[model samples]
Target: MRQYLSADKEKELIETANTLMAKGKGLLAADESTASMLKRFQSIGIENNEENRRLYRQLLLTGSKDLANYISGVIFFHETFYQCDNNGKPFREILKDNGIIPGIKVDKGLVPLAGTNGENTTQGLDNLSERCAQYYRDGARFAKWRMCSSMSSTSYNFICCSNLSERCAQYYRDGARFAKWRCALKIGDGLPSELCIRETSNVLARYASICQQVLRKFSFFSGFRTD
Candidate 1:
């Protein structure tokens, strides 16, 4: 079989993950979609406009340099990734300056899966490989795609792993190319069904395997949640 990840590459991935997930520091998930952002702004009585969005993220990225001490990394939505500070400095640079890692949320908002009750799956798979390559070139070293476990089955493992890992290996040859898959499990009446668990676990296992083969890295997970 072809060697997808060399031993050296594997070591690098492990070390990077360990450093990012150190004892106290945490990764911030600011990957909410624009629609989701709007809902949040409404909750707080603020208008959800382009400037407001940029300003909000600007505050997060332009905070005290001491932010690195508590936040190991911050995951930004695509717009936030490219958004600039008042002086035209990109937010990616701000994170780098503060010794914080920059990551991006690449998934388009969730869409309903037809023929299923309240089931949904994430979009953004179209040209995903190309987009990820471009994101890595621009500055993002890691990316995330979240899925609602109850919405889809575990069938895209092979395709996703192969597609993402193949290009990610070349793009982030030396640094990090974390392929983060955020899986959310729900707990409602007769929820978290066995099917959901199996589907999520199976897909995650595939992702993990490819990380071993081609990545040796990804948004290395550190915690789990159920709701």
Candidate 2:
């Protein structure tokens, strides 16, 4: 059941989406998981710990205010979304002050898809409404869910909105501005089997439908790939 957006909700979504699409500006993807961070840090002989993560994050956000001129928004990992810098400023607040919008990664991670060899899909749909509401309360304005095509060749990362007027509308009222999801197609012999392509589109459509219904806003996205 797709809900209707309030006047203010529609206005806010349009504004946020416009801001993100500003020419010469784009999103900074800083939402690396701890495991991902560990791999990068190890290459430089740096320890992967909370303090180090916070410091590194600080270095990125606390830079010149001009950072906002180039970076319209920042996508944060769950831990980073809740973290603070050495100066005790919350990371989200820093981004706000710097004129950058704050967003979050909501997917738990990936899981092996059934009847497929090494193919996977994302998890974390459980209790999503509660999580999105709490994230909004804490200053997150957007979200991303990592989804992958159930094909051996490629994967996807989806970003979208989530329930009840007290549920999804809360995101808009509380700051749900933008959502994103991307799925890819590959070019090769027998590549993009009709079944896999349909599977991917169906999943994306279902997820997008869910986001719009729960969040009470309009959102459209597409992702296709070659070779």
Candidate 3:
């Protein structure tokens, strides 16, 4: 049987999420895969390698404590999650010692959406709920999934949020309590940017809408809300 949350426990989790984003602050995303980092490296004219990645992350991690204060957590890729800074402190220890939580990006690289010409969705849900339980046990306070999707007249209404949101909500219910949804809108090659923006907004809105619906039902049954 699923354990229902007591009111105090529910309030505690909600307060924790708020405390995480307090003082008009947000999260620092150090979680970038090799391919994504390479794209960013191309823009900066730098090589994409372990050292380069470490240096960039260290720059952020060792920034003024003021910046660290605004950043409640640092989401790291698997490689960075295990690396150490020059002082030989593991990245996890460095952040935790500074009061910043360390999180992991658990999604596999993006894959093409079936029946969509070139669009894609994130994978890695194969054992994600179980993996999340392990990450929680391993001291991860949160996990992240960066989802990508696009909309167009040819495929404007061809969107699905059910499975993705279900998995994420389950993660929150299971252990990882905070979740974020990211969508991308690209316009080019005879496609107007405005159309892309509009479509992407619609998709994101719908995604949030569905998530809210799920949470409502979840609260109804669980007798609590993490909103």
Candidate 4:
């Protein structure tokens, strides 16, 4: 309930968000962590070194001039933030010059939420304001924090909602224009019952409401996988 952004700041946030969500435009999530990127590269028989990573991202960011038409925004990892395109232009500048917004994934990773049967929460809230301010100064207009929960029929709704609301408000105050939360559900013959579905929905709704209270655009990504 603590409001830290000025009226102008709030308006700026809203306008940026609206522009990213403009007609026929969507976000491109290119913020895979190093480990995740390694796995992806390995699957395609490519080495996952720094140069290769940089090249891959450069290709994605500068592959076509028409990308901005459909890719309104791009969420980048920390490494990509400082990378330059083939033309020596910073990736952030390249995106901005093409009328695309640049964002960063701010979560450190997932950590176990104590006293639960494998429930986890996203880390990286420490010094969040400082980090967000720096990212904003570096040409980032938005940020993402991913909070994940296991589909083990546990009552994690309370913890998930409270953590998301608190962190969403904090991130908004620190200059993030929008945020994304991912909740995953495992599907099986006798899994993902009514209880799990209802709990996930309730948690997402609560998080969305809290995000609105802080004047930030909220996006929910639900993953259905069978393990």
- Ranked candidates (TM-score, high to low): 2, 1, 4, 3
**Candidate 1 CA-lDDT value:** 0.61
lDDT of 4 by residue, 1-227 (tens): 66545567656655765676788988898889889999999999999998899999988989888999898878889888889977788898899899988888776887765544455555676555566667777877667766565644533333334344223322242224666656554444444456555655655444444434443433322221111
Over 4 Å off, model 1: 1-3, 150-176, 187-227
Q: Give the TM-score of candidate 2.
A: 0.78
Q: Of the candidates shown, which would achieve the greatest TM-score relative to the real structure? A: 2
Error of 4 at 187 (Å): 11
Q: TM per model?
A: 0.73, 0.78, 0.66, 0.71
lDDT of 2 by residue, 1-227 (tens): 44356667667776777777688988788999999999989999999998898889988887666898899878899899889978787889888887788888777887766654445566776656667767778888777665554433443332232111111211231134666544444334444456555655566555444555556554332222111
Error of 1 at 212 (Å): 9.5
Show where candidate 3 strays beyond 4 Å. Answer: 1-3, 43-45, 153-177, 183-227
lDDT score of residue 7 within candidate 2: 69
C-alpha RMSD for every candidate: 7.8, 7.0, 7.7, 7.9
lDDT of 3 by residue, 1-227 (tens): 55455566556556656645677666787878888899999998999999988888887787577765678767777788778788887777777787777777777767766544455666676565566566666556656666665545453432343233223322232124455445543434433344444544554444333433322211221222344
Off by over 4 Å in 4: 1-6, 153-175, 183-227
Instruction: Record all residue pairs in model 4 with backbone atoms less than 3 Å apart, i.e. clashing.
Output: none
- Displacement of residue 101 (Cα, Å) in model 1 is 0.7
For residue 153, give model 3's deviation from the true position in Å.
8.4
